[model samples]
Target: MPWPSPPVVATGFPGAVAPVRVGRQGIYDRRRTLVAYELLFRNHGGASADLAEGAEQDHATSQVISATFGDFGVGQIAGDKPLFINLTRGFFTGELPIPFPPHQVVLELLENVEVDEEVMAGLRRLKDQGYRIAVDDFIGEPGRLPALGLADYVKIDVAAAGDAFDEVLALAREHSRDALVVVERIEDDALFARCLAAGADLFQGYGLQRPVTLEAVSLTPSQLVCLQLVRALTGTDVPIREIEDLVASDPALSLRVLKTVVSAATGTKNEITSLRQAIVMLGPQQLCSWVVLMLLGGVTGVDTESLTMVLARAAACARLAPAVADLAYTVGLLSGVASVLGMPEADLVDTTGVAGTVREALVQRHGPAGAALRAVLAYEEDEPCAITGTGHAVYEVSRAYLAALSDAMLTVGAVAGDS
Candidate 1:
């Protein structure tokens, strides 16, 4: 037997500077333990915040790959975990070599990658080199599968699979007994459980972050009340006393507000006795935002885990664009409402009287607030973001999200305890 060859990597551009950082999202096994991280290219500073399309996308992706091997190195980026990297058709059959050790890399062949004799030969060579292979967004009968024999993983889009999931799973298993069956786009707990039941080996998507709206969803009375109050407050310049009265009348809402304020204010301030005082102390805008946060979670029937995730995402958006942070916060908090409530996002925004810019961002990613919100959402999904600004990088984005997670947990915990 001959010795296996190493990954083929391209030479670096002498003067080219890679982005300040890269973003990664984990692929979790059935045990909910991380097995791999899918790397995404992100720009430094706020640049255009869309996934680079056409030639730009190719260049951006190549830049990421080159930088991964060039400046950061695989070990520093992925630690001991395997890196699942996407390969464009060009990279797949080209002479460029992957710089990382074969055992630690998983070449993800894009669903649309051109597959032919050369591609097949490349796959064989990669397998021989000890690199795992995965077919991205795979959809095919077992007998007709591309890369079926060489692939170590087959990723299926649950939304696309629909009723064919069981059949697909069965076929994939029949053909590749040892390969992992990974399910993507799982939208909620129910579907996640269903995928697990169907013998899925790994999972992805925001399904764990919020409920997936398979059908129409109705709002409960408490949720309705929360929306109405938010609309009234945000739509008009309501007096602080009136706002305080509205919250004071709702014992559950009042209790949560008081608890959050009291808990947060612990050594810093004197005890508060009244809802009005608490409202003033929390700042009217921020306190109302928290109430809206509570309402959104209530409407969605979100578990603690889901609520925590939503709040952290919202806070991270605020951190990313401080000038429009308030609007960004609102956008982050309500971003998942559509999936949970089974309502059009536009309808929810209209009903809630969200600012036009916020609504625009939620719907179309139109403004600075929209850009910031998109960046946060993109990071969560481990996808590309068209960041447009100066000095924004993966390091700052990661720090903001982590900080928000801590703050959100404490806030949500207080509300949960009081409620």
Candidate 2:
């Protein structure tokens, strides 16, 4: 499999050395877990925060942002920046891979999904637990109203979504005036002005990170091991002892764990031996979540990483689902299972004999249930994700998804308890 380039931003370039490319995502000024001045940079088609040359100030700033958020070449965030990460359906279900701190991150929900009631309640629970939530495409919907009412922030596109937008913002304000409403896709000055007039509290789009060419970087074997362990830890049946053994399998991973355990940064300064101790110390739930989130930064073995992604996406859905439908719960994570394993999605489909709706979702993105299953991919790309429509409609659908996920995990945990 080919290696994908790591996300990067030019640290510095002579006003002449290929200009720095940046794409921006607006964070509500009132956001507690997001950076207001967040910038996503592109160098060629890749992300390069390493300023081999250019202005000293630009170089320094790039290092701070990239190092703080781009895994710092270790697949981990710098801990200083507001935790901002794209939230996808897969992530909600525990089907995809993640590589950061969820407690500190803000999940920017997209606007293309088919959410249900279960997903909404689950989201409410997550929100109660301290996770910040934001809805993209702040459109209105009947079924989605329940979930939308619960969101902390709402985002809209002034040019496309409009006074229809104001109506939605007004609605959000009516419920939670403190809820930050963001206007995305601001093309020019006039639109920006309109957004201000409409009470938009945040902003995003090409206005932030420019598209650049890609530059692929090579990784050492240790990096590979760390990623494998992350994948292993995330498996539905993975055990704490298994995770410990995998980490202990390689000296590099051992060192990474030691550093993480002792890093005054993570706020945990505990000591452990072997991998099991680390798992026990960290707690399987927290340990697994951290390992998966860390891998979100970027890892080697494109295929494995992609599989990890599919899994993470599915997992996110699981986290959201009220009832694991059509094996959509497991199939969501496993549908892409073959791709990452280097086998054919077709063969996996044949062997797993997954339900037709699920297979349709994976192959064509068509089906009512698929909306719940496939939304994971849409979430990963951060594209418009819909779960009914804007307002509380989509929110309700998201809640339905989360409910199913909670049920599945609880059932699985209980079964595991008996074992």
Q: Which candidate has the highest TM-score of all?
A: 2
lDDT of 2 by residue, 1-419 (tens): 22222212112211211222343344534222344433344444556444332233233333223233321222223234444443545444335433344455566554544456556755676677677777657666555555566677776666676658678667767755667776677676566666677776766544443333322221111335555665786578876656754554332233234333332124554433223444455555555544444344332222223323443445555444435442344445544344333445555444333345545655565544355555554433333334332222344444443453454345334322432
Error of 2 at 67 (Å): 11
Candidate 2 lDDT score at position 35: 49
Per-residue lDDT value at 254 in model 2: 36
Give lDDT tens digits, candidate 1, residues 1-419.
Answer: 32222112112211111223456667788877767777766555543225544455455555455444433445546677877777766556754434344656788887766678888888888788778988887666443375776789988888888898888788777766788988988777798899999899998876543211111122221343356567767766778867754553332344345444533332444544334566677665556555454442323222445445656766777788887765566566556434433457686554343345666877887776677766666556554333323235655666677787788677557545544
- lDDT agreement with native, every candidate: 0.59, 0.45
What's the lDDT for candidate 1? Answer: 0.59
Residue runs of model 2 more than 4 Å from their true location after superposition: 1-70, 73-79, 93-103, 205-245, 251-266, 269-281, 290-419
TM-score, every prediction: 0.43, 0.46
Best by lDDT: 1
- Residue 172's lDDT within candidate 1 is 76
Give RMSD (Å) of candidate 1 vs. truth: 25.9
